[model samples]
Target: MKAKQLYTKPAIVGLTLLSSLVLSACGQSVESDGNSNNLANIKTTTLASSNLKFSEHYLTRDVRDDVFYFVMPDRFDNGDSSNDNGSKTIPESAGGFDKTSNAHYHGGDIKGLTKRLDYLKGLGISAIWLTPILRNQAVQGDSSGYHGYWPLDFTEIDPHLGTNADLKEFIDAAHDKNMKVFFDIITNHTADVIKYQECHGDGKPLFSTSKQLCEYVSLADKAAGKGYTPFIPKGHENLKTPAWLNDPKYYHNQGDSTWQGENSIYGDFMGLDDVDTDNPEVVKGMTEIFNNIISEFKPDGFRIDTVKHVNMEFWQQFTPAIIEHAKTQGIPQFFVFGEVYSGDPQELSKFTTEGDIPSVLDFAFQYRTKDVFAYEKGTDNLNDLFSYDTLYNDHNSSADYLMNFVSNHDVGRLAYTLDQSLPEASEQEKIKRFLLSNSLMYFARGIPVLYYGDEQGFTGDGGDRGAREDMMPSLTPDYNDNNLYGTDKTTADDNFDVSHPIYKKLAEYAEVYHGHEVLRKGTQKVIEHNDEPGIFAFTRTLKDHPSYTVIYNSAKSAKKFIAANAANHKVVYGEVNQQKNEFELAPLSFVIIKTI
Candidate 1:
């Protein structure tokens, strides 16, 4: 028997929960420069998310439909250069290795981000997820907290990244722009220094060494005599352990190791040390930190770090407390998305169960898409990869909650990865693939997230440090090269050559996404594909509206596709002449069509 169709309208009636929510219209509203820098403008306004429309769907279960622009605070624009605090000479203890000077902190702070809210707002970005901002060890050259990941004190904001007041202003400015902020949180591990004393060449560790190390008492084995936790290095004779980890308050230690080695969590991100979320103290401290962030930052949502490393029980206890605490502050709606970073559908599904968390990064689908893009398989992998029935029918959280992206900071840049084999692919060809990938990201189901510099055709060869580069204003003057198509090119530190056609094309794509809800809320289907010639096309349809079809010519030459009985459709993003049924799609070109 065929499955029953889901009705568009709700069968049950219920009163909306938050009465204080001021729902706005769907059009774009510009924020005038009206003393935005002054703190006086903050409290008078709903500081983080006021301009855009907030639907019950989003407010109810932390479902964010808006496109997200993920920013690396230090790498993005540095608005307040005055706040540069670290030593100019890089320190040995930092997370930055010699290869990546861009990862070095240039002291980009909350004020800096706030100053550039207009830039993000103009891009039609509704959500912003900044890297971790918790207090971190401030050793020069130790790019730890500079990238916002080496968390020291969960309670305090990094002094180098500005003060609590600056954060408030940032949130306020973002709200003024109708943008939501997602705090990149880490309850998984503290600063990476195992023996801070040895690493820093000092007796005193950076932070309190004792409180950093905590006793190990499992939730099931709550017995106090279970003994202190020890850091055991794998396959090593010498156990390099922290001497004073018994005290629970002075320093925070990742409680336990994950049962599965590196790949259990997000396979791509293994730099993070796994914490035992099962310990009661671990649970308590994490809950307190989350509550503190909610009380202080008033973030629209949280992107929980390394969530799968922790036990299911920890989420069972922690998420509710965080959400409940936020509701009392009159911030009735609290959104939470966890990073379960597993490509296995079953593993990702485990983290999305009820009461566990509302949403998770769709690593399963994302990795599959990345693989398809890398392998040049067109849409061949999409069908088996995206188990829409299991996704929609399973007992996990709402399907809309999933976050999807083709490339992120942790992985190889899409442009860089795609251009590896086709190294000499023409500028137009490179731009073609980039634009097509982005169109897919936007029109596809789930919340789409764009990395910091993906819009400008940024290229990164490898993972981690390689994937991250400083966003320079433009290509540096010294280096110049021409591709197979003989187009002039220059290399800058991850800077955009705006003269490149892709940047303007990205602006158009962003405009389309920001202008229409159909891109975010529409249902999608693969309309056409030719396996032999490597051509693929898909269509997205909004409720009772005209459908939009996206076609791509993945071949090296222009290809013609015959759409039988299809008439009067205008190609928007791709190369398609208006003359007749026979139209050519340029190599690596992407086209979007809407029924006239």
Candidate 2:
């Protein structure tokens, strides 16, 4: 595929010293002004520097139609080995970078991703969402922060991942391929640096050496000395950069969370120090940090981490602030979605309706899709989930914004789920279910987020770390040891073969989605067929675009179905037995029909 020329504006001349300083920090430079100390003229010069030319088309595009590919950079590919162990200056108390260990860095960096732009573009991805690249805690417990969640410094890039310039190059390369980049970020907590020394009471909020020994205590009670006090990591308390986070008072300092009510909301997550998001200063600090990132990198979107853990009011303030800030930088339709991690649509929709997050990960749809496709459960469960779309603020566009996925890094993979849910099924049956589920996800009413290794058929199970296997099997020694599906696969290669069944199917689906406007951005209505077991159908319609219908049959027997507008429609994709105005969908098959 030919690369698209990213839009660029002519560089502006004349810059104040203050603007030159700011530009220098961003690796940009301007004509120096004689009055080096003059701060008054800085605003004008900086504004000129901020006038970057992004693809106007990308900036204004509706993200609902995008096909997102989420990749954990460290596990994807190692384009640079020198940055693997990170800098010698940075301390790595834990065993340091080890590709053999799932917990350590595997050397995959931004350069690796930049080198694979063609692979992703050919796979039909419109946007790439990478795990956080911020400087993370080098070591925590038995594991290292290779996953990029345990941020040590929010303002700087992790050396293990790449430098700031490497990130810019990756973004530019993606845009050159007509793809956008959505950065994953955390706001709820930082790396676990502070711990509590003693446990005072069973349930009154006393810190214990045991990380998960904290009890529920109201913020008032904690202030009154009724709760556990956290012991700051003496020398490390101020290790976090950007300076303000160094303040001990900014943390809740509560013991690890039990994931229950007040504790879950206010306590530490897995001993990661929970920030006092409710504090006005912390909120202001977080907002400024993310705002600076936006103004500097100008990402097309953000995948907010741990949104539910923070107070709803924090989002009410933070979400709009980021969006408005992007608008000021000339990106008007900046997409931002949060990870709610709830299987209930009502619970997930609250992020959008109450929290003001534009959209959230559609865990509700993911669960139902798994049940229907993997377990051969009826489509009624999925229909039920879609029924709750009304709970979202914008019901008509709910599917457009919600990020839908079959599996992600935090959960068991689709293949693993299929195998565990149907151990009795043959290998062929398992593959069938996997393809069916992915087809439904791609064709369904939401932006499809393809987890990195799913196309290559990585089948790691048991959730969490298990699901986060490397894309290229060559990086890890025990790549084939934990095959959840019992496929006996050994030595995973970064399979970029276009002919691979799953990859081909995904590419085809992406083509159809991009070729047809209705499928990308349309109103969807489920086609009910109570008598038709193992068969599910839905129709997508948009103004002035061709209406399309998608049908999936999971049963072993071919199922015939009639469309009300069948006479005007033709099969644009997928193979099915079509007879005049009737269509017979083969068992475990999917087809898309478009109104001619």
Candidate 3:
């Protein structure tokens, strides 16, 4: 295979409060902007993916062909600063834009995203996955819902981002360029409107005591006299849409969740009103709501939020309905994956099998291989990780569909992870680690999702607010103090530097990835692994196509291996250093060979 093109997202941070959906899952689409923000004049991408074309075998679109770029709308860009105040006179409804605080909105909207489509495309992206863009509870407590998680209205786009029509234009724009879009939806809970009097005293919404202190009372415990109750604030009873959400009967009222056993499924998420997913009315309502969302938005797929927190039965019913409904609406290839957040492969498999999710964010992939790439662990550790791939292989779901990522909105970035794990390491060493982590992700068996700002080498001090920096530029000290890869530019400066080393390096990798059908969809087998940091080789073979060998060196010094037919094989990436029986490898480097 010579070359083929396609697929790219930022991540979840508004992260979101979907409607009353528990265990709802969706899929990720791959994309980047073609405009490149005038980057055509800034610098020509040496391996710009525009020239690459997918083979005939992959002409039809599928989620696996995507490489999602997860973006938090508010932090990405500010195309229209006018809406930054949310077009409201009241400060509460305005969703305050405070560049001084990362917790507040910095005014990135759908318009900004629309303005930058070429930027993503020039970088080799084919799809876009934005964090919840649904109208949200603008101001929640002291923190703002700039990340789009606290949904005040699931029916509309947040005023701070743009109007619903603007979203349609953004989608239309992407589609015109042959890209897909995925909505990061939430169904487990809504914004924290339903509060407990037990925590807030006499229908008062504010409390000096944190809601986390409100002790949980399980349904079984409530049956035996230990009961916890919730109430709607006097004036705010009509807060939620679809009318049914205003009633207390629709919720579990099991108090806040510690994210432990019983409460994990039934309790509120960070005090947000948790939906009673097992209830019949709630189930039907959520199904109708998301189905309507699909019909209206016409997204290619969905990236469902908080699957594990919802009951399993909710998923068994919900996922199938979503897919079937999508088919009826003419979206036969609609994708649906969930956020399980667990690292155990066996437990991870359950969601795909019994839970009925199509795929899940590959947390197990990161957890299993993070140490190997970020730390000093042996390359052989990856064998144990890949061996568990079969666990996800079943009727409805397969390991191949898993959305692979090195870091996300909830988790700190690769830059931060590399620095934290190797605190004393040089900047170059950290860059090498970042590149390596992504290398494994790009060439691996799953759909690779690139977090927004990672290509710019954004170093989020940690996850959450720390990770959500402004791509346009920043005035925040917390973000400016941090270091970035390949550039001296801080968060205070505009970061869409096409000339940056990491960005170019990733573009090169994406070029290789999108160009090769086997690398994106082939079955992989470990050819060599060692207890020490050394050569880790694997074979990716698809039936009727030539087998390919992917090789890498995790060692600091050059490593040696032997490949007799190295000459016959076409070197797709990296140099082949051979001396009769042995070949040499650069530190933290890799090679891909299409074996004849």
CA lDDT of each prediction against the hidden true structure: 0.55, 0.72, 0.76
Instruction: State which candidate has the highest TM-score.
Output: 3
Q: Candidate 3: lDDT of 519?
A: 86
Q: For model 2, give the 10-residue run with minimal summed lDDT.
A: 21-30
Candidates ranked, most accurate by TM-score first? 3, 2, 1
**Candidate 3 per-residue C-alpha lDDT over 203-319 given as tens digits, one digit per residue, 9 for 90 to 100:** 446621145746788879978877666777777787777788778889888787889998998887777888999999999999998999999989888888989999999999999
Q: Write the residue-wise lDDT of candidate 2 on 188-295 in tens digits.
A: 998876666564332322223245555556778888887665565446657787888877688887667777788777988877778999999988999999999999
Can you give the TM-score per candidate against the true fold?
A: 0.72, 0.86, 0.90
Give the lowest summed-lDDT range of ten residues in model 1.
Answer: 19-28
lDDT of 2 at 558: 69
Decide which is better by lDDT, 2 or 3: 3
Give the alpha carbon lDDT tens digit for every residue of 151-229 in model 1.
6556656666666787888888777656788898886665544432222333443333223232222433434444334
lDDT of 2: 0.72
List candidate 3 stretches off by more than 4 Å. Answer: 1-45, 50-59, 87-92, 207-211, 564-567
